[model samples]
Target: MAMAVLERFAVLSSPDLDEFRHSVSQFLTPHRLTPLAGNTAGVHTDLSKTSVGPVSLVYCRNSGVELGVHLTENVDYYDINLALHGRNRVTFGRDEVVVDASRAAVISPRMRVDMRLSDDYRQLHVRIERQALTDHLEAMLGRSAPAVIRFEPDMDLTGPAARGWLRTVRILLQDLDQPAGLAEHLLAAAPWANLLMTGLLLAQPNNYSPQLERIDAGLRQPTPVRRAMDVIECDPSADLSVDRLARAVRMTPRSLQRHFRSALGVSPHEYVQQVRLARVHEELRLAEPGTVTVTEVALRWGFTHVPRFAGLYRKRYGTPPSQTLRDAL
Candidate 1:
């Protein structure tokens, strides 16, 4: 499971140099901050953070300083720094990158980073939990990833895809600031966070890119039924259309339908519905009392019509979804 992000904005700031470092460490990561020689001006730090599900968005600005950040032993998540002003030299393991307006730095969960920031440095930091990303990679490949996914340190933000990612970040930031933002609702937050994760995986070059390309090219092989099952199990919430499943396994829809009927005794569409209904039932069973509704769980698993979904749920489980929820509570 992915780590949950904060549900509301948190602001941390301090004028004392040592206090500033301590505050930042508590909010983000543990690190030592050292003011450069002859740069003894009052230390000022400001950070505003909001979490959209499992992703954390942080806006940070600090006075002139150098930081010695250590994650060698406790590398738990991926951190991406997009420079908004000034400059930074970020070193990860043996590699280093100069981060500026045009370049972003991606620090993997396995690496230790040391950063040197210029006087007017400001940045947007995106933190993604490792498990969440790993799950996504597995979904994309229709199988478990072989190892931890690694990303190129330097990302060119001038590219078209990168620009689109930035646009999404901006939109999320704007919504976070609004009193009635989309992120305030769980239903909306889930998709928005998922979009950010998917966007980064697609726009950036990563260790899994080659394998994903192979799948897209329809080169390597998996049995049609096995591949289809993998896709459904990996992401039961996806829109699992017959055509989509057919293309994923490199088979015509007609052939897929015939095979599914012959082997599973059900059409592809029916199988998808069964998977979704099971997912909804599991969620309802585990959901906190009074915090979630049957409709929300149904919609989350792609069931749009309440009457139709309830009828199917009853037929499958011998009880209405509302009754299932009540029993769980």
Candidate 2:
């Protein structure tokens, strides 16, 4: 998957030194980019950026050339740089870390940075907007904070928290490839953005970790119904019968059903079916017109009966699945 993330949003691919510097300055951040290996004769700078909600996923590579990039001022956004191939040394202020696939350097605002890239270095930069992050932090705190949230520079990506956060990133990247997909829907996009933001805030230790921990210690564990719904949402195609879901969440079947009814006003079966219908609706909208059929789409999401699915799809989406596919194409 080298240089695979956000490859569709290519901005530049050139060997010219000035052009390479200009491309990085335009597509990513303003930096003094110079070749460290004497000359950039055979080096190709590849860059791409795709914006999704409050963040942008940028893929960049300077192939066959050691490079040095300097950012002399404080940046406005948080840069989570994950190396895809080879290695790089990112220096944030006085702290420096060697970043690779398993280690990410999270550069927060109010810091100067210097980056040394190996000859084969390639990376994906998750650029989170400053204002959006501040707003999210305020929402999480349930109050205004006068001080900015500053994250520790080096993030260990081997932990479960980082892995889960990366899942949301992969989901967003997948959606960005679809013309009529979840990222384009406000309702869906907001949750994904919130999931990413909330995950990062909770997973990574920051200036507000102590406060967040205090708040969390005072609250009860997340409701089982929410976990069940997350299971379905994360992988709707999984076997999600009430028995399985209840077992997954360590609850009895009857108790799980009761909780689902009380919280969602629907039984587990109904909720799963609703999720499947929604998934089918999304699939139809993102599928190519000539490549798929309504029945195929229905069955993929576990809707076996054609007539019932058509009726449900129409009632839920106000259109037949075929019509949605047609519109998408």
Q: Which structure among the candidates has the greatest lDDT?
A: 2
TM-score of each: 0.64, 0.65
lDDT of 1 by residue, 97-146 (tens): 89898889987776768888777577778998888988777666544453
Each model's lDDT comes to 0.76, 0.78
Write the residue-wise lDDT of candidate 2 on 1-329 in tens digits.
Answer: 43566666888888776787777776566788878877656777788887768877888888878988898557878888888898989987678999987888888887779999998788888888888887788666544443677999888988898888877787778777767877777677668777888888887789988866644542333567667767877877778888999998889999988877665556889878877876787677679758988888888888778898899777766777788888889
Model 2, position 93: C-alpha lDDT score: 63
Q: Positional deviation of 204 in candidate 1, in angstroms?
A: 1.2
In candidate 2 the C-alpha lDDT for residue 151 amounts to: 92
Task: Estimate candidate 1's alpha-carbon lDDT, on a 0 to 1 scale.
Answer: 0.76
Estimate the TM-score for candidate 1. Answer: 0.64
